[model samples]
Target: MRRSGQNRFPEVDALRGCAVVMMLLYHMLFDLVFFGNLKMNLFSPFWRGYVLSGASLFVGLAGLSLTLSFSRERKHRNVVPFSKYLKRGLLLLFYGMVITLVTYLALPESYVRFGVLHCIGTSVILAYPFIPRPWLSLLGGLGSIVAGYFLSLKIFPFSFLLFLGLKPPRFSTLDYFPLFPWFGVVLLGIFAGNFLYPGGERGFTLPNIPAFPFRGLAFLGRHSLTIYLFHQPVILGLLFLLGLIRFPL
Candidate 1:
């Protein structure tokens, strides 16, 4: 999704593609376990860290991309509108809601109420004010992380606030990413983007190397959202065809 007249950053796209690969691996493992084809503890420390790392890469890149877009837009138009972010956020949220609906019908006991899409969408909208202020973004990001640590220690009774890092005891979900700590990752990415790509131009130098090696990953990154929406179904279908999983009658 390159903006008009904006420089394309293949590195960013490749990194995002790498994260997408990680996500695909994680989901494949999860499906294997869920279908009784594998016996592993996904909640173990190692797996938890794996999940966090992948999510951080995705969310952080989102923030960084937002800053780059904002910088370019500001340069071109002399003013960046909030409506761009609003429309994008709403689109992602709508996609998240569609996932929620599908999951609710497929697995009512554990549907994704607020998954990565929801978090990223909400963060995109929330991070707009801090886009031009790197220092404030750093502070806000760190503060959110600290606050999330404390917030996770207690359980709130209200289910309506689940997206805000508050939840009742035993609240189970297949995928969950609340704002607190996760939003911090996005802010940090914003800070990094502003610092690294000031005025929408690269602030550092790199050797002029060919992009051939990264072509595949960059392609994956460019179409990440579409892949994310369809990968699970494809995986499940393959597993079913191989007799690795069975659909409930």
Candidate 2:
């Protein structure tokens, strides 16, 4: 969360920071595999579950924050505006496109065509109409989960529906999160946000932590997008340099 208004939620920021930390740990293991320093089944059931958990947390947080935004607007004004959500979603989509280009150039074989960024961006746009109706969003989210589970079993002729969880039998990507089950997680977050934090304000009190670790996590959460874009390059570069010391590329 970027501060769009005066109101701030420390709990949300902390939770997001926790997600970021979890993502970094997972990516570090992935980088180790890429660097030939470790050999583990990346696509193993355990790893897949790990990835799903992290992604769910991240996407769910996005939905929660969106609800908070709407609530904040409604508090200040009589209505909530879709323009702000649309603007942010489009910006995220553009960034996702840039990532697609970079990844295709860097690692064409396993490029990200419809990664988490794309899913989140598209989900935000699609979720706008349902923001006002928390119960409906909840039901839709559950339905998506059931639908996506079955959809994943089937294969499409083309990769165009990759964003929608449809793809060819052999299609694969380094990062892929279709708007099926994942979007359902976001919708659940919206429901939780509305239920827990009505009107974008805390429903219960949280004790103050006068500690630096918590503050550092909050900072990381606030600037997650910047970190996500650069962390891979940084990790890869360091690993490559380390590998050169003992083995030839």
Candidate 3:
């Protein structure tokens, strides 16, 4: 399975690419409506609920990829480059911090205290020591999600874990993905990574799934961390400039 030097898993990349594309499209629409460039029927409860599933796809795929990247294979280094992985995870957290600062400066009302990207990056670091054990990661991930569900009630006084999914009495944020259940998802990735190997080498180019979607989506997924931070701001800025130029009403 695992050979030597420059290990490449195009299938996982493609999967991630798919996730990223879906996310980008969703965010594009979300950004458009958010900045008032256009209106969406998200005002309806059903529509709002439907859109929420978009996050699930992003998160679930994130988990899957996280595991895939870190799992051990023959001679290709021990279960995902720990040092590099940790470094990458920290970088993601650093970027998340930058976003938090920007949000505080721009939109304190909807600042991202513990958003998905933040959670994913941080969870990756937190998940490092535990990747070797599959069952433990599974239990941890499941427990985290379940715990998050319970904690959302906001009964406990642990404000810190609020980011862990403990809902503050009237809390609200534009982006939020706490440590508990969210970390569980990453752990799910770890578990899946440990167990599954996409049978036969070569990687990616699944015949059943069409090529265009696969290419665009995989591209998005590969650059997800970068895209996640920048997409909204770019969309919002373009909308603003467009509004100023044409629809100055």
Candidate 2 residues lying further than 4 Å off, grouped into runs, are 1-5, 207-212, 244-249
Clashing pairs in 3: 17-217, 17-218, 18-217, 67-189, 141-184, 144-181, 145-181, 161-164
lDDT for predicted candidate 2 compared with the true structure: 0.83
- List the lowest-lDDT window of 10 residues for candidate 1: 1-10
Cα TM-score per model: 0.94, 0.91, 0.79
Better structure of 1 and 3 per lDDT: 1
lDDT of 3: 0.68
Give per-residue lDDT, candidate 2, residue 75: 78
The residue-by-residue lDDT of candidate 2 on 62-100, one tens digit each, is 989888889878978887788888898898899899999
Clashing pairs in 2: none
RMSD of each: 2.4, 2.8, 4.2
Model 2 residue 176 CA deviation (Å) reads 0.6
Q: Give lDDT tens digits, candidate 3, residues 125-232.
A: 788776677799889888988888877665664567666676656576777888877788788876776666432243333455566666565566677777877887
**Candidate 1 Cα outliers beyond 4 Å, as residue runs:** 1-6, 207-213
